[model samples]
Structure formats: C-alpha cells, structure tokens
Target: MRPVGCHNEVMTTEIAIIGAGIAGLSAASELAEHRGTGEGILVVEAERDAAIHTSSRSAQQLIPSYGPEPVLELTRWSIARLLEAGNYLAAPLAWPSSFVVAGSPEDVAAMTVPGLRTLEGAELFELCPELRVNPQRFRTAAVDESAVRTDGTALVAWHRERALAAGVEIRTNSRVTGARRAGDLWELTLGAAPPKTVRAATVVNAAGAWADEVGALFGAAPQGLRPLRRTAALVTLAEPMPPEHPMVDDAAEDWYYRPDAAGAMISLGEAEPSEPCDAQPHEGAVAGLIAMIERETSLRITGVVKAWTGLRTERPSDVPVCGWDPVAPGMFWLAGQGGYGFQTSSALARAAAELVLRGEVGDWLSPATRDALAPDGSPDQSATPR
Candidate 1:
C-alpha cells in the first residue's frame, strides 16, 4: 500500500492508519495479521523515526496493576505478549519486572485501586530495599507489585520495525494534512515527498497526543483530547545505579523515579496544562522531583544530566478512548492511552482492531458500556461514565 501521498504508483489497501506511534503501528500490524499478504497496511507517520515523541521519550515500565481496573485489564491482556520470551520483534523485549511504589497516606489510598490490592509498607520495601521512608512526605505507603520494569521504548521500535517488515508501508515525515470521505473510501492528503493521495475504506486515528487534531480532518471535533504535560530528568550518579530499584512514586505525585542503567530517572508526574507543541522539561518540575528524592531517600540532589518532557494524552474519564467514533463511520480512534499506553498497548490495540475489522464485541461489558461504547451510537450516550 502507498502512503497518503506517494507519487510512486503503488497499490491501495483496505485501511489507512495515521500516526506511526505505538497505537498506529499496532493497528497496522493487527490489520495485516488478519488480512495477511493479500493486502498491505499503510502507516503515515509525522515524525522521521518511530517513537520520537511520547512513545520513545517515556521511561519504559510494564506495570499491569499500576492503574485502574480497566487499565489493569488492558495491561493484563497485553502482558502475555510483553512478557513473551520471543515473538515477532526485531529485538528481544522480554525484560525483568519493575515495581511502582505509592507514597503518602492519601496517595497510597489513591493507589489502592479497585480489583487489585496494594502492597503494605513492609511488602513495598521488601520488593525494593532502596526505597526509603520519610516522615514528612508520607504517613503511609503501598506498592503495586505487578509493575514490572521493562523497556517499552525497545518494544515500540520492535513493533514499528516488525510492522514495516510485514509489507506495511511506513511513510515517515509524512504528516497527514487532510482526510475526506470520497464515495465509499477515504481520500487522505499528506505533506510528504511529492504531495499525493491514497484511498481506503477505513482510517484509524492513532496519532498519539495529536489524535483529536488529526481526527478533525474526518469531520471530528476535539472532544476528549486532554494532553497533560509530564516531565522527566536523566541524572547520573557517582556510583553504579541500582538495577533492581523498583520505580517509586512520591506522595501526591510531587516526584517519582525509576532506575536506568545505574542512574535514577525521575519525574514529578505533574499533569500540567500545556499547548500541543514540542515540550521541554520545566525547570521547576525537575527541581521539585530532586527535592522529593532528597527528602525521601539518602540520594543527594545532584544536577540533572538531561531533562525533557512529553504529553500524556487522556480522555476526560482518564481511560483509553478506543473503538470508533459514532458520528464518523469507518473512522476509528485508538488514542488517549495516557501514561498507561505502554502497559496497555497490545490489548487495547487488539480489542479496537477486532471491533473495526470484525464487527463483533464481547457482551461481557456492562449495560452502560454496551450503550456508551457502541460505535454506531452517539459518543454522548448515557449520562454516566461507562
């Protein structure tokens, strides 16, 4: 299949996917698995390389029970593939597990998610000895042991490369300009090598944080596209970093950290409001993270080796917005993975692909979900959250 705009006289396919991030790549891969070599998958990526945005910038971790039950369910569905010793990946992704520790009496309570139990103070520290308690920040603590530390960045690259190898056309630097319905198919315009247009019956908007902005081309409005800014700091220590250090969350999310190659990578986990632009680490955020680490543990506050920021897009309900838009037929949305994207990518992508490619969904969802999640109905269905 040709990209939206490739002057090269190539073939067209059944589907066109926008945004070659994890969601886009996963969708393309999933579609190909169902269709096989008979049809190719076309993926238009705005960036030059895969995972240049939040997909790659994230401090990779695989935490199945690190979020809400729905998020945990998504993570559990994807955990098999994530933990598989070998699969269709360019590089091995099977890595050791990681942990996510919750701080403060309130924050630990907040971490006591539904359908999952939070580890006690002793259990939390037992998993990771480096974690220290502070009288000031936390009156209590809890641990989510299912938080296995893995390289999600590697998994992202692996997914992209595998999708490319599967006869999937990955057009990098090809920012999608417009998407319009032409007859029964979609005529997509792109800003890439020698402007061109590709036609497909279906279009999947997996454009990461820019999902809503991209969906608008197909007559979609910015509804639940809430992109929150999250900052990260790459600081190296004088001694070898503890490889076994479980990822830790500070009280009130003021600061959080994970070990990376003998160095501790930290974040304030701040969901600051920001515009949809190239994000840079906020000085105040980094400073706050350092202060939290210093206050909680024996670690000293050294200068940040490097700092950067990325948007963690989420819906109003803070859940992934998968399936298709009700108003826009043949237009599917797999955005709003938020910080849980890496952990829940596989299952969410599969569930969405199934709904798009095959029109059948399990009746296991509640009555509210059946009404609220049906793509044929209005997204405004049901006054309560599904």
Candidate 2:
C-alpha cells in the first residue's frame, strides 16, 4: 500500500475544491470527468500532501452490513461503484480473510444487528486457526463474506492519479483565505503567490477536520460538524502471521486490529468529542491499544514502531452532510465523512455529482442530500423507486 510517484504542476480548473481527502479527491475526479475538459477542477488543500490527515492514518477496512443501516447501504452502493471506478482502488479490491471474535456472552449477543449471525466456539477456532476461543469466557464468533480489508492510502493515490489525468488540478500548500459570493460566482482567495483569486460557479467544502472553519467564511453554518480524534498504532509483529488472519473487532467498536507488512495496526477506535483541528494521538489511547491487543490475543507488544492520530469529521446525525446547503445554494457541503470516507468515497462522490449536475437524487442518499441538494428526481427516472 504505497504510491509510485510525485504530484503534477500547479494549475487551475473550473471547479475549485477546498481539501484533498478522499472526499475532496473523489469529488475532483468526478468533477473532472463530468466537465470532460483538460482543466475544469482545481482542488486547494492546506496540507503539503494529498492525504496527510485522516485519509492516510486510517485502519483501512471495508465492513459492509456494519455501522448503521443507512451507512451500510452507502457502503454497499460504494463498493459497487468502487469495483468499476476505473483505478480508484489500490490493487484490485479484494475481500481479505477477516475474523470478529466474541469473548463475553454480552459481546456475542451484541453481534445480532439483524441479518448478522453468531458462530459456535468450535467454528471460531476453525475460522481463524491461530485464535484461541475460550468457550467458558468467550461465547461465540461471527464471520461474514462482506468484510473486506482495504488499503486507503493506495485508494487515495489512485483517485489522485485519475484526477490528474483528467486535468483536475490539486494545489497543495495553498490554504483558502476566504470564500464569498461575488455576484453569481464564488470568489476564493487562496494563500498563494500574490493571493490567487479563484472564481467558480460552484464550490465544494471538503476540508476534512477543518471543514467547519472553512465553511463559516462562505456563510455556511457549522451544521454540527465535529472533527473527532481516532488513535492508531503500528506494532512490530513478534512472528509473521498467516496469510489469512481475520481482523478482530467488536460490536461497539471499542478496538480493532489488522495485520500489515510492517506489523499489525491496532486502533482504539474512539470518537472523542474535540475541537475542529488536526488531532494528535493520545498517550492514554496508545496504552489502551496495547491493553486491548493483550485482551484479544496473548501476544505481547513490546516495541512500537510508530503511532499517529487523525481527525474524522462527523455531523450531528453521524451520517455525512452531503450535497448543497440551505444557506448556500451553489456552495456544496462535502464534509463530515467521519472514518468511513475511503470505503464510502464512490457513493458520496456519485451522490454529489448527480445532485450538482443533473439535480438527480437517488434512494442511496442519507435524506440530507435530497433535502438540500435536489428536490426533484431525474426527469427520465420515475419519481418513486421500482
């Protein structure tokens, strides 16, 4: 899960994107494809690299039928599009071997979120041979065909390269100073040389953790966008694990871990309410990861190679705030992807594009996109779903 080369030269486009996370990068690629021009989308990011924040530091996994119902639906639609999005994935998107073990009876019971199954103690051992299933302590195990281990950084670079090919200019290190409605166009003052002014008919705010602060400059309300901190660490493996080691996670999602080339990456998987900004990995969270790993497996983690935290922007209802806003008509709200950005990128960008161009609102949206982005469905399609 690594990139091959460097970025392209600085250029401008018709649509100016605010950030370059998966959401922003995906939007750029879509806008570039839709525009079908050499240069019609310019993405302005504050970070020096494309995905220096949450997009890079994520414990990449595609867990469909997980999270909430609406999010799962989004994940379903996203994975479908991701399959055919032409180079949006790292390698080919493959469903890797995964395991979700339940220790306490309470933990086993938590697995049933409708359409989910709990396995026997013997089956848990069969699913993952290395894992120890204490029938006395741990009750059951859950396995499914939907859990897909992913490489998020590779996915980001994939979209980035595609966007570049489509002439979607991504100017990193160029922070947006201000954005306001000047007549019918958006006047974006960037922090570049002589303060370059970008004028576009539409603007997408995808500033990741800094989404709220950026939206406010353009008269877009905070809309309850909270950038929470999630801490993750990469520990050196004591022994090389098997090829098919399932990722061990919980229902409440207290902690999770996956095997990587370097080692295993463990996540505290916390969503702490914090101020909107670049978040750092908490010290206590690191300790908590070690403890969680110990509880899950007997493997003792003595050396930690590296650790970092990223801010996942969330909205009031936990679902992303996609599409246009009530306050800003032409201005689009593409923020609040939370931790599911990479997995949900394909659907989110498709939703945004359909809303922006054709004013088409599909059933796949979270209802928020329908309310603000498109009132009328596409003229060709039926009003109600078949």
Candidate 3:
C-alpha cells in the first residue's frame, strides 16, 4: 500500500526477494517474522510456480554432518526446526532414515565425524543385505542414524504458506530484467507485458543458479557462483527392496543408492559445472550411475522408471554465500547453497534475515563460520576442484 514512486505501474515495498525457490521462501518467512507491522515485503519469481527447479529436484535428505564445518554447523542449527516443521506443514515433512557411508579401509579410517559409528564388513552386510560389493573391497562403513528423509516439495510449500500468512506478496511469472539504485531505494524493471517496475529499500538475490546474474542487474560484482548439474535415476529392481533399508553411499566411489518404493533411487554424485538453465539428464550420466550401482550392489536394475537432473550452484569455497554484498549497499546475496539447501534452509534463512535487518551475523553462526561464508571473502580458486 505504500507508494514511493509516481508511476501507476510501479509497486513499492520495504524488501523485495527475487526468487520463489526454497531459499527465497525461507528467507521471506524469516524476514516476515522480524519485520515491523505494516512494513511491505514482496517476492518476485519468474517461474509459473514456486520450487519448479532445484528445490523440487533435490534428493531431500537431511544429513547434518555431511558438508564442511560451516555447512555442518548450519545443518546442526536447522535440525530442531526441521524436526518441528510439522506445526507449519499440512503433513509431516521429515521421516527418520539411516545413512550409511562405505569405503576402503584407508578411506574409512580418514572419514571421521561426530556421532558416526564404525561398522565392520559383516555388520555392513547385516545392515543392508542387498549391498553386493566384493568382501575384499568392503573394508569399513559408518552409520549416522540421525539422518532423515525430507519432503522437499512439502517443505517449500510450508515456507511459502508461512510467508503468505505473514502478508508477504508473491508475484509469479514476473521476471526481473534490470535494476538501478535510486536516491535511497532499488528500482527494478520486470519483464512484464506492460513493463511493471518495483521500488524497494532492499533486495535479496536468492535466484539460485542465477544469483550472480541477478546481482549484475544492480551493478553488483559476481561472486563466482558456479551452477553444477547432478543427475539421478529411479530404477525398478527384480525384487522388492525393503522399505526400511538404510540409504547407502560409497564416499570414495562417489555413488549412492536408497530404497524408493519397489525400486531404488541412485546417483553417481557427479557435480559437473554447467551453465544456468533448465537442466536435463545426460543419458551417459544415467547409464553410468546404473552401471556403478550394479557393480557395487547385487540389485538387478532392470529398467529405469524415471530420470532427472537438477542444478546445484556452488560458491568458490563450495560453501553457501549468505550476507550483504560487500560493495553493493541494500543488496544481499543468499545463493550458492549447492546440494545442502534443503538441509540448511532454516539456519541460513535466519542468518540472511538477521544480516538484512541488522547488518551483522547472528549469534547462531560462529565467527569462523561467518568468515567462511562471508560474501566479501576471496575464494581460493587454485584449490582442488570440487
């Protein structure tokens, strides 16, 4: 209801979020929680619907101890919220699922994390009898009983609902084409038929793969965000897989498989760099995953029921980039979550909101984590590629 510009086709708000994906929706929900009464908030999305990209295509696993220390910390911070998401969701969002990691003796010996229990060759077979690696190749395994399967679609919907309930306006099919800074606000031009404009005091670039492009519209420098393609396929096995079978992953081989209904879902854990676009699964990648699974497991994957690909945008450090742009005032970066977006959504959203509202990292994030995920920090490109 507040109008800052004179044009009739122009709308104004205190904060404008430039994506409807899980990250944007989560940040909008948190910002709504801390916003003052009557303060306007708007979410602009180019897709016809929310969560139509990486959000819905995620593996949807909540593994708190999976990523780097900063990401693990964020995942740890999000566990409570994910567990309590039933209050906001129409149905329960997460279900307990076992996570098992396997590798050679040396590989397993180097793999250490808090609360992970080591398992011997027999123990691994006992846990997942269908696993078919040669006894000699199977050295050791670790189990994280705390892992859970998350409903990615339901979680995004829950966040959208919460943001809407807090009076945040969401405009779909509205793409932002350009942006410029006015006296004290950002003026955004949308790719609408009538060319509508939006004026806001602050803008949060949660555009996932297109985060850097969105920032460039407002003269912000790119943070070297790289969108990578990850391919997955669902295969129907000759025999029914146990519903309670734990999700098994070979860290050294970079492949994982888990039970899905009558079959299993598998991925090669490939992270090939790609341009920002609607991703498509490469037949070779799908076939490669199937081949690896057949070699590593006893299950005969007769046919593929379905296959898909999603983009997981990674930063230079392979950690999420969340915070205000160091060079651009009123512009915030909330992209580069890679594959950990769903697991770390709550904590990252809270941190983004705190940074936008107070211009500082919140207490939930430690000083070390703050430095690692800072938008201004220079990433070491010479390090080994992720």
Candidate 4:
C-alpha cells in the first residue's frame, strides 16, 4: 500500500477507485494485471483500513447456486478463478459446504439451481444430521457441491498484494468528500483541514454501502442502491457443531447456520433496509434468530457469544452495477454487490477491468447478462429481496 498522506498537491492517476473493500481491491488487481506499468492506478479508502466494512464482516462463502441468474453465472466463473489461484489461499476452498433445505418438494423445485443435487432419507441425514428433517418442515434437502467456504482475509490480502506488486497505490484514511468532472478527468476532493485533490482519467465507484453517495459527488444520478442490514452471531451450544457441518440454508431463505471454530454461526437472514453507516447488530434480531434456529433445528439450547452486522448494498435487481455510468462520463459503477460480493468478485472484477480498459466486456458474458449489469440497464427495481 502506498502512502499519499494529506498533501495540498493534487495527485494524478490513470484510474482512481473509491473504496478499498473486496470489490475495489479485486478490480484494482485485475486492472493492474492488464495495465502498463507506467499507467497509475490508485485505491482510496475512507476508513483507516481496507475491508473493515462488509468485506471483513461477511460469513464468507462462495455459494454458486445462491443468487440470481446473473450472479450465479459470475459465481461459477469466480469459483474456477479462485480454484486456479488456490495456492494463495490459507485453507482449502472446497464444497459440499452449503445445503439448501425445503419443507416441500414443490418449494425445492421452484427454487431450482443449476447442478443442485437433491438428497433423500439417510443420504441427507448422513451428511448433516444436525438438520431437523420432519414431515412438517425440512423434509427435502439439496446440496450445492460447487459452493466453497472462502478465506476472506486471505483473499483480501491476495488482491492487495497483487495490486501493489503491479504498481497500484492504496491510500487509507483518504475519504473522497467531493467530486467534479474536470474536462476529461475527474477531480476528487479528499479530507479536510488540508483537502487534497486527486485527478484521474476514470473513477471507479466501489464504495460498497456509500456507493450512491459517492456517485452523487461526481454529479451522477442516484442509481437506487439500497444498503440492507444483515445480522449474524456466534453461539455457545451445549454441543459443539461438527467441524464438517455444512452451511444449512432454509429454502425460504429466512435463516442459515454454519459451523465455526467457536461453535456455530447463525443468522435470521433478514435484509432490512438501512442508512449507510457503521452498522450495529440488534439484540432483538439476534434473539429472534436464536429462537427460530432452536425451533427449526435439533441444536441444543445456546447463548449468543457474539453478534455483529454488515450492510449488503444492492440494486433493485439484486445484481451488481458494473460498466460505465450513463450520466457521468469517465465514471464506472462497481457497487451494489449485495450478499454475493466475495462469491462473484473475481468475475465482476474481470468484467470491470475489461470494461474500464477495453470499453467492452467481450464474449465472456451473454448479451442480456451484460446489459443487465450496465449502469443504464433496465433492471426490475420493484422488489429487493427481504
């Protein structure tokens, strides 16, 4: 990480990315990989450290069958890329790690996922006996064998390392408070007391929850990004969760639980709308989740050891916003990743890099999928998943 402290002099770069989370860092790494050595790429972070927001807080996973059609495509692509770069991972990222359960076969069929393997009777219980499968609920189970548990910390470090080695500068504690398009370049004002300016040929808005706000600074219209609050907790169960216990998700997408070294990590999986800020967990939400988990599963009584919250910013389509902003020239939208940030990051980053450098995403994605991710694309903003 390069340190460009509070200096009055205006720094210039070929590309400047706002936000140093998984999206920005991964995009930087990808962009740097294809860029000339002399072409400058800068990553600016508002927090003192990168990925301290949603990136570090996620119950890290790479669920290939977990999101919308577009996201699933990206997730599948990312899995291959991550596996190819597995040498950089601290732990093995493999699957049969995520399981989706339903009360009825109809529900399971409705939520059809590619490559989903439906399990039955002893075969299902043998894999995860912790699940309570009765006639009333959790009767059917399916496993996404392609879903992998990702090492979030290691992945972030790998991206940061790759970016730096490729001559990308990452500066922390440099919040972009103002933005203006200066002729052909975008001028971003950072910090106060001694505001420093950064000029770049293009600006990437990967600010996570603050994405829309950052775009407003650059005179771009609101992209309708919603920062939904999600809560998760670590609990002390009467019995320790098996190390191999797979992540169990309700077919309804209401709640999920996975084994953690401490015990088990659980979430009610609510996506309540929230204003962007340092999010805090609600005791009531945690309590509700505990009650639900106990009622639905055979896990014994437990106490919540820790609880936290993170925002999964999303567009109304529940898909990420990639490609150039229609109104703001030289400004690219790389936000609204929602809950599938890490899972689809590699593919999204590659798409972003290609869009930023070559002006097109090529044939990697279907024409409709590419249009769906574009800034001006018509996305169904009617309902954001709860």
Candidate 5:
C-alpha cells in the first residue's frame, strides 16, 4: 500500500481497525495470522489503552446458554478459544464457576436454555446459599454447572499481545476525526499533534458505542446502533463470601450478581437507551440494585467499595451486527455486541476477518449463522430480550 494525502503526511496500511477493544484486537489478531509478511495491519484507538470502556467494564462470564440463539451459538463457539487463550495470559483467563438462573415458575418455563436443569429444595440451596428469599417466591430455579468466570482484563491483554506478536501496529490516543473514501481506500484524519492520516484498503468499525458515529464520519448510514447504559456496583459484605459461590441471576427481576475479589458485583440489568458517551452509573440504579440484593439474598451490603458503569451498544434487534455493510463498500460492521462481546469475541472476530479478507464466511461458522449476524440482514426483533 502507498500513502495518498496532502501535507506530505499519509500512513498507509492494508487494513485499518478503529477501536482497540476486544473486538478490534481479536480481529487484528486473526487478520495478522493470515496476512503476508509485509501486509500491514493497523489498529487505532481513541483511548490510551485497550478495553477502557465496555470491554473491560463487563461482568465477564462465559455462559454459553445466555443471550439469543445466534449469540448463544457464538458464545458456544467461543468457549474453546477462550479456554485456549489462557496460554497467552500471565494468569488463567477463566475460572470454573457455576451459574443459577432462578425465577418464578412461569418465568422459568418461558426460558429456553440449553443444558439447563431445574434445581429444587436442597439442591438449589446447596448450590447457592446466598438466595435467602422465601423459596416459594421463586418457584423454579435452573442451574448450569459448566459456566466459567471470564477475566476480561486478562483476555484483552492476551489478544493485544497476540496481535503485537503477529506484527499488528496498535496506535492509541489516535482518534479518527474525519474519514473519507479516496479511490479504493479510506483516508482517515487523526486528531493527533500533527493531524496524522491513515490510508487503508479496508476499514473495520469496531468502535463499540461509537460505531454509528464512526460510520457517519465515513459517509455510511446509521445502522440503528443504540447504546444502553448499564450500572454495576461492588459491595463490601459484612461477612466473607465463598469463592465457590455460583453466580445467581434472577431472570424475572432482570438482575444478576456474582462474587468478586473482595465482595460481590451486582447489576441492575437495566438497558436504558442513551446516546454514546462516557457512561456513568446512576446513583438511583445502584441504590435500587443494592436494595434488591438485600431483599433477595442473606448478605447485607454494608458499604459500596466501588461502582462503575459502561455502555452496551445494541441494534434494534439486540443481535450483534457483524460482516460488511450492504451499502458501505470496504467497510465492515463489528459493533452492537452488547454484554456478550467479551464471551463471543473470538468466534465473531474470526468470522468477521474471514468475511473481510476472503469475501465469504468461514467454515467455523454456519452459513445460517453468517446470514443471521450479517449487518444487512432483517432484524430478528423477537430473538433476544433487551
């Protein structure tokens, strides 16, 4: 590739990925794996480091049975890679953690999750003693012992290291201010000291919450990407919590919590729609979650150790939007992953890279799945709950 811009300043590459989150890093890794010795791949990020937003702020868990069918399939496909990725991390990337989804009988009956078994009486209490609510309040409970606690920070670092080892150049604090198509390549103007520019044959918009904004900067139409605010709090309990405690999720109430390093992390499971920004946890939401935790569990949250929030960008259908945009040539859509991004990053990245480099879906993903996750596919509005 050759540089093409004014001011005698143009950096060229074969592929340019916007956003250094897990999605972008993983895609860069896959692309680097298949690239020629001199084929350049560049990953640009607005933040100073990777996964500073939704990617690192997630309540990381590898629950294959979670999300819509398409998401579930991707999660299932990603588990092996997540497990195998532990080799790249200094410490284990994932730890075995049981998962329990408890709700009323009607709520449990409506949930269709694979390998989920009903737990009652002793089995339920034994599995998750934290649930002190009257058993009658939650008539049904489903348990999945195969779940794992994914280390988000470690996973991002692993992929970043892999991409670096594969000769992928990652430039942080290089925000893309303007983008335009120059012949068969994209000319991206960066907000740097000297106003740098990057020219690439293909551009992958893995900008997470800002996906639509990046797309519009490059003359692509919005794909209905909606960023929702999700709040989570780390509460310090009066007593020590068992490290082996399974993650407990009240499906009917739309909240889930699990043991953290010192205390526990609780989420309100609220997906309130908002514009893309530096998301902050609402005090009311955090308080509400704390109250709910107290009402549902025996553990009393004495104090909040820490609290944070992040955006979970979702399309209208709630399914991830991947693959190339039908109308935007040389531009790929790798956004709207929501909470499932970390768990499904490996599989989604591989499939996306295949689509970008080979113009077809990889064998690892089914043709049906390929079509379902394609950016231009008709929205399956009923597939996943917000």
Candidate 6:
C-alpha cells in the first residue's frame, strides 16, 4: 500500500485513473475492493489534493428526478444504495424535502417524476415561508420528499481514505502531459521537471472538465465534452430562513436556493460554456441570482458573503460518458457527468469497476442504461424524460 503523498521514482501499474475527483477515487475504491489488491492500480491528480474542483463545488443534493432519463436511473439507484444507513457512506445521509416550483401547471407537469407530488397554499407556504410573498409568481410546485442532502467533502474524504486503505497509490500533482498507446500498454508522460513516465495496461479518463483533452493524448476521438461554468453565492439574509425550509428550484429551474448555515446558497443555474480551467464566480451571474431571489421570495438579501463557481462537463447527450472507448482499446471514458456527478457517483463507479475488471457490465444496470452510458456516441435508448 502506497500512502497518498508518496510516489515511487519509477512507476508502472495495471490500471491508472486520470483524475482524483470523486469519480476517479470512487471507481478506484470499488476496483480495489473487488480486485482484492490495489498494488496494480494508481490514481493520478494534477492538483495538490483530490476533489478540489467540481467534486467539492456541487450543491450536494441527491434528487433522483433532477436529470435526464439515463442520469435519473443512476441517481435513483445511487439514492437507494446510500439510504441503506451506513452501507455506502460513512456519515448518515440527510433526508431533505426538495421543491420544484414553476410558473405554470404545464411546466410542473413537464417535470413530474415517480416520487413527486403537487403542493400548494398552506402546505407549500409552510415548507417554504419565503415563497408566501410571491405565490402568484409560482403557479404550481412539486415536491420530492426523499431528496437526500449529501456531504461532498465527506464523500471525497471517505473515498480517498478507502482507496488508500485498499493499497491504491494516489499521486497528486502528477499531470499526464503525454500519452502513447504502445501495443497492449499505454506510456504516460507526467508533466514534471524531469518528465517522469509510467506504463499501464489500462487508463481511465475521469478528468472531469479536461476529459476530452486527456483522451486526445491517447489518440482517442473527442467525446464532444463541453465544460459549462455554473456560478453560486452565499447571501446574508435580513432574517434567517428556517432550517426546515426546503431547497427551492424556482423561476422555471433558471435559479435555485437552499438553506445554508449563514443564510442561503443561491445559484444562477445557467450553464455558460467555457474552457477547462479553475472557474471563478461571474459577478453578473451572482447578482442576477440575488435579484431573482428578492423578487421571487420573501427572503431579503443584506449581503453576499461568498461566491464561487465550478465547471460541469457535459457530452452531446447530456448524460455521463462511461464504458470503454470504441477506438482506444485500453482507454475507458468516465467523464461528462455534469451536475449529477455526486448523486450518481456510487452507481457509476460500481458499473465502471465491473466493466474494467470483467470486460463487460453485468445485469445490475438495465440494458438501455448501459447503452446510454457507452462511449461510442450511440443514441440513448432509455425512457423519454418525464
């Protein structure tokens, strides 16, 4: 077992994961668990630590009905797994009421899912007192009571520790600058002072926003992954919202806000296309969200104490890209998760481990789901979005 910060002068492994975010760490942990030895596995991160990007910047809510059909399947499965107290995550999952408010009944109907139900008047106002002032603005609303509030920080730490305990070597600050397929193996050049090289039998591209870039180094065709910047802010309210208040998705999903310890966390919810980099909050986007919160709810914004942003990478299908690359034999695609990364991590990781170790996915996932997640750019055959 190699400690997280330790790295050998000369390195070679059977499998190498190209990102230390939740997707990479979780997949590493699962692969280590089933393989029974992590000595052959290595996790490489460009950053000094793991989960310093989108993994830590997510809103951290697990809503099964909040994504495309393929993503919904994974999210539902992940939620079910996480709910089995103390089974998946070390800390307990928080059950929080999640509300989706719309300006019309048609919009509300458009978002209907398996566990969502209509809410109005007193019941709705009781759950979100701030919405009482602008009830007319929100003509209809639906609630998913099973929504779980996850701890992204805890999730990252847990997966990192688990992978390390299983003897997986995690090398931070080791960026793959060059990748060449050599017969049955891949020769990866790390961007170091001396340009260290490592050879691996398999490579997993889980580089979040930079997945396509990493794939190109190995001659793998681009997956058309678009990195979108999402901005959010923490506002100090004139009066603190009740802790029991449900997280609200208002303005036809253009903006949303959830209760935070300081006051509230509001997001613009706009997916602005951007290049891969450390994203900073757009002042105009944060201002736009704050203004909307004032107009749509009773919560008064006194000051915005904090503002931050993250990049959510999406493929053409808007569903996560998994499975082995059709062109690159030993290369696997595990990126393009977008905003549903945290909610869908566990299910995706399990399926990825199965695919990598067994060369095929079992029946744990539906045939349609497996096809939708394939890396060949095939059309998704999953159920139509509700």
- lDDT of the structure predicted as candidate 6: 0.83
What pairs collide in candidate 4?
Answer: none
The sequence of per-residue lDDT tens digits that candidate 6 reaches over residues 1-386 is: 65665553557899999999989999999899889977799999999989999988888888877888989889988877667744555566545556555556676777566557877778777777777787777766888776778778887777788899989999999999998877788999999755678899999999999999999998886899999999988888999877667778864676888888889888888799999999998657777788777887888999988889999999888889887876666888899999999989989999899888886677878888888898754343122110
List the candidates' TM-scores in order.
0.86, 0.86, 0.91, 0.91, 0.92, 0.92
Q: Model-by-model lDDT, in order?
A: 0.69, 0.70, 0.83, 0.82, 0.81, 0.83
Tell me how many clashing residue pairs each candidate has.
Answer: 6, 4, 0, 0, 0, 0
Tell me the spans in candidate 2 whose CA falls farther than 4 Å from its real position.
1-13, 85-90, 99-101, 129-137, 362-386
Badly placed stretches (over 4 Å) of model 1 are 1-11, 85-92, 114-133, 301-303, 362-386
Model 4: number of backbone collisions: 0
How would you encode candidate 3's per-residue C-alpha lDDT over 1-386 as one tens digit per residue? 54556343889899999999999999999999877431498999999988898998888888876888999899877877888866665677788888888878677556547568988867888887766456666667888888888778888888888889889999999999999888889999998766799999989999999999998898775889999998888889988788778888886866788888748888878899999999999758888788777787777898999888999999988889887675667888899999899989999999888778776665777888877777744342112111
> 1-386 in candidate 1: lDDT tens per residue?
76675564333667788887778887777667766641557888888876778876687876775665577677766777776744655555656555554566667666655444465556655654445445444445655556665576667766676676778888788788877787888888776667668787778888887888987888864556778999888887655456766677665654677777637888877888777667888658777777767766766645678889999988775677776676666777788888888888877677666676665445434344333333333544322121
lDDT of 2 at 325: 53
Backbone steric clashes in candidate 6, count: 0
Clashing pairs in 6: none
Q: Whole-model lDDT for model 4 versus the true structure?
A: 0.82
Please report, as a residue range, the 10-residue window in candidate 4 with the lowest summed lDDT: 377-386
Where is model 2 poorest over a 10-residue stretch in terms of lDDT? 375-384
lDDT of 4 by residue, 218-301 (tens): 777577999999999988889887876788877766588888877888887889999999999885888888888777777865
Model 3 score (lDDT): 0.83
